[model samples]
Target: MDAVRNPYTPGTGRKPSALVGRDEVLETWRVALERAERGKTDQPLVLYGLRGVGKTVLLTQLRHDAEKRDWWVVQVEAGADVGLRDLLGEGLYEPLSEIARQGLGRRALRALKTALSFKASYDAGGTWTFGVDLSGASGGGADSGVLRTDLKRIVKDVSLGAREEGVGLAILVDEAQDLSSDELTTLSMVAQAAAQDDWPVLFAVAGLPSLPQTLSEAKSYTERFHYSHIERLSHTDARAAFARPAQEEGAGWSDQALDYVVAESGRYPYFIQQFGQSSWDAAEGPVIEIADARVGVARGQNHLDSGFFRARWDRTTASEKRYLRAMCPGGDTGIGTGEVASRLGKNLNALGPTRAGLIHKGLAYAPDHGIIAFTVPGMESFIGRQPE
Candidate 1:
């Protein structure tokens, strides 16, 4: 019971061996990957959710499964500063380079070499540079549109190359919400082109809750992609998530302990893992009991305050902090924007800044058309710990 092996990492990519409670998602991912292998030409997939909801874990699992089936996988983290060239050049070049080396043909390899060698440079001071080198791809050009076009061509070429080599191609992009509008547009065009050619090129993207809407805004074609929203585990799934790892480890927790942890965690996977780890660490005997859970809760609460909760809190503006505090009592039920504005006695327009700020920091999310709520359960407890 030396804790649940730190399944809930804060900022790093998902740890595959530590992932749990995603069988349903895994099944869906399996179907997509299988469809790609069969050359079905289905629309790409988009996975979105609030922060810490295990979207990363699901994507990582899918990547592993695809690789097992001999699919060539490319991964990129799309950020505000990321460009289409950076994503494509980094993601596609290595695999395509290897394919070229395997003698796919001189033209394919040379085109790839040209694409990868195109470099755009930004000076450490303030200037920009653009030119093609045999060494790297750069971000500065007339427009990212050109870079995006080149990227699409590379993906198409690579997919065709992989098919000839008896493999499929899968592109995985994480943090996709931060991708620029133009970049998303280019990606959609690429997917469409691949489909037209009847090539098997699968795109699996994971990002914040707004990603689907944002992608659609970028390109209407994105509306056609399959979207999966990863959410918190159900109570039963939460209990199983906690109990399964312990069972596999040759240890067990008392029913009371499990119930207490689940109730307190509100079925959030991150919280469940946090509580489970704390309980495992605090248990005095092989079988964790109620008393051990009490100790674990205290320890876990401390960890939440200092670790998970404080990090997000520290990143918010003063006004956003006020809005979060005002919404504390609502917990996961959240509050309407109008109610929050009324409670704060601020102009409705002013609330826009606060709402956007909160959403950007990942502390709040839109639960429905008009209701905004804490992104995680037990958020009130964390907000209550804030300085007065």
Candidate 2:
């Protein structure tokens, strides 16, 4: 089989040939966007899931869908190094500048310009020069270095300008769990202003399962945000997502073959694509048999360990890796921090920073008090291989 003809995409953040089991969420956001634009009701949407659950893919797809309706969409991400202010400055630069030049709300525009400037550098013509007509629209926006106090006015202004254009602003933030409390507050204030003024702006954030807890520490009003907890696909949806892409490429899957792929992949989208791709490549003819799926699953193990699992493992510190590997023996759900401490021969109290560090790295998360699990499934097996 030609590599170019492979229908399954196992690459990071790549959209699959078939997206299944998420129709409800897609439709839900659609209705919410429509209503928000009409000033009926609005709430920020947060999609929480473990790694490889396709939250990034969903966000990308949603942005595409919204853009088809002529909506203004901005995709930003908070990462290991990037802060929320810089991410906002980068993602919102164009939209803020575009809406400002139209002059819908003059004062708000000035305030937004100032706030963004604080996020950027003074040498860059006073923070984030939005080129074109905004070359001189730099000063008098938000006071320098005061992001929280000035955020509401800037957002109110931007959303108003967006409403005037008849298309709203959609901010998609990935890895939002990395955001600080103050950063989350800045976003909350924007959402509050939008609801009060009927401005058309909504945030769609995607991050780990711990994100809701992380956001709650900032404001109890997070209940105002629509929460979507992404889980594994159902048996039917997982099978369809497993088969449809290869079927479209003219490869047929036997009933047993499809079942094996689905079961072995545990309904995780990333693993399904990995196993499916390997199964397709392993088959001699157009139809994939059970033997091919078995071999594919075997071959796919190395692919997954070397690729997906390895990425997360490589990001861990030596001490963090020890903590995660110790976690493996406990089972898939999670391991007690006490057990982890015993394995590491360290005091539980001393291990607190290490546990927190792993969570920050996105390698693992705390599901409950004194318990933690890897953010990605099957990490136990991955840790066993080649002795990390």
The candidate scoring highest on TM-score is: 2
- lDDT per residue (tens digit) for residues 240-301 in model 1: 87787777667788998989998987777777777777888888657779998999888988
- List the candidates' TM-scores in order: 0.84, 0.90
As for model 1, its CA RMSD to the true structure in angstroms is 4.6
lDDT of 2 by residue, 40-133 (tens): 5478889999889999999998898778776767788888777766676567766566654554444444445554645553235544554434
Worst 10 residues of 2 by lDDT: 131-140
Q: Model 2, which residues run further than 4 Å from truth?
A: 94-140
Off by over 4 Å in 1: 1-12, 16-18, 93-111, 117-148, 367-370
Steric collisions counted per model: 3, 4
Determine which window of 10 residues in candidate 1 has minimal summed lDDT. Answer: 121-130
